[model samples]
Target: MGEVLWENIIVSILAFAILYFLLNKYAFGKLFAIMEQRRELVVSQLDEASKTREQAHVYVEEQKQALNQARQEAHEIIERSKQTSNKQAEQILELAKEEADRIKVDAVREIESEKTKAVAELRGEIGSVSVKIAEKLIEREVKNDQAQEELVDQYLKEVGGRS
Candidate 1:
C-alpha cells in the first residue's frame, strides 16, 4: 500500500510539471503579448490625455492674458478719451471767451460812434437856434455868410469850453 501511494504522488507531480510547461510555452506567451499590448495602449492614452491637459492649461493662460490686455487697452482708450474731451472743453471755453471779447469791443466801438453822431447833431441844432435867435434879436437877416459862420464858430467854442 505504501508503494502505490508513492507512485501516485510522483505521477501527480509529473502531470503538473507537464501542464505548467505547456501553458508557459503556448498560452502564457500569447496572454502576455495581449496584456502588454493593452498596457501600451493605456499608457499611450494616458500620455495623450496628459498632453491635452497641458495644452488646455496653456490655452487658458493665453486667454487670460488676452483678456487682461484687452482690459488694459480699454482703460487706455478711456483715459485718452477723457484727456481729449478735456482739451476740447478747454478749447471751447477759450473760443467762447475770445468771441465774448470781440463782441464787447464791437459794442464799445458802436457806442462811441453813436455818441459822436449824437454830439454832431446837437452841435448843428445849437448853431441853427443861435442863428435864429440872433436874427430875431437884431431884427435883421445877417447878410455876410463868412461873418455868420465865424460868429457861430465863436459861440460854439465858448459853449464847448464851458461844458
Candidate 2:
C-alpha cells in the first residue's frame, strides 16, 4: 500500500511540473508583451488628451480677449460720434447768430435811408409854399424884385432855424 501511494504522489508531481514548464516556454512571453503594449498605448492616449485640453483653454482665452477689444472699439466709436455731433450743433448756432446780426444791421441802414428821404421831401414842399406866399405879398405891396428876394431869404432862414 505504501509503495502504491508513493508512486501516485510522484506521478502527480511530475505532471504539474511538465505543465508549468510548457506554459512558461510558449505563452508567458507573448502575454507579457501584449500587456506591455496595452500599457504604452494607454499612456500615449492620456498625454494626447491632456495636450488637447490645454489647446482648448488657450483658444477660449484668445476669444475672450478679442471680445473685449471689440467692445472697447465700439465705445470709442460712440464717443467720437457724440463729439462730432456736438461740434456740428455749435457751428449751426454760430452761423445763426451771424445771420441775425447781419439782418439787424441791414434793417438799421434801411431805416436811416428812409428817414433822410422823407426829410428832403418835406424841405422841398416847404420851400415851394413859401415862394408862392412871397409872390402874392409882393404883388399887393408894389415891391421891387430885389426887396422881395431879401424878404423871402429872411423867411427861409427863420424856418430853417426852427427845423
Candidate 3:
C-alpha cells in the first residue's frame, strides 16, 4: 500500500510538469508572439496616421494660399477694368466738350458772315433807291442835267451816312 501511494504521487507530479512545459512551448508562447505582432502593427498604423494628418494640414494651407492669390488677382482685374472705364468716360466727355465748342464756333462765324452780307446788300439797295429818288426830285425842281447829277450825288452821301 505504501509503494502504490508513492507511485501515484510521483506519476501525478510528472504529468503536471509535462503539461506545463507543453503549454509554455506551444500555446502560451505563440499567444505572446501574436500579441507582440499586433502591438507593433497598431503602433506603425498610428505613426502612418499622424504623418497623413500632417500632410493633409499642409495641403489645406496650400489651398488657402492659392485662394488668397486668386482673390488678389481678381481685385487687380477689377481695379484695372474700373480704370479703363473711367478713362473711356473721360475721353467721351472730352470729345463731347470739343464737339460743342466746335459747333458754337461754327455757329458764331456763320452768324457774323450772314450779318455782313445782309448789311452790304441792304446798303446797296438803299443807295440805288436814293439815287433814283434824287434824280426825279432834281428833274422836277431844276430841269437841268448838271443840277440833277449834283443833287443825286449829295443825296447818295446822306443815305450812306444814315445807313
Most TM-score-accurate candidate: 1
- Candidate 3 at residue 88, lDDT? 100
Q: Could you tell me the TM-score of candidate 2?
A: 0.64
Task: List residue ranges in candidate 2 displaced over 4 A.
Answer: 1-26, 132-163
Question: What TM-score would each prediction reach against the true structure?
Answer: 0.75, 0.64, 0.69
Q: What would the per-residue lDDT of candidate 3 be over residues 9-107, giving only the tens digit for each residue?
A: 889999989998999989888998999999999999999999999999999999999999999999999999999999999999999999999999999
Which residue ranges in model 3 land beyond 4 Å of their true spot?
1-17, 142-163
Give the alpha-carbon lDDT of every model.
0.89, 0.86, 0.89
Write the number of the candidate with greater TM-score, choosing between 2 and 3.
3
Off by over 4 Å in 1: 1-4, 140-163
Instruction: Check candidate 1 and list the clashing pairs.
Output: none
Clashing pairs in 3: none
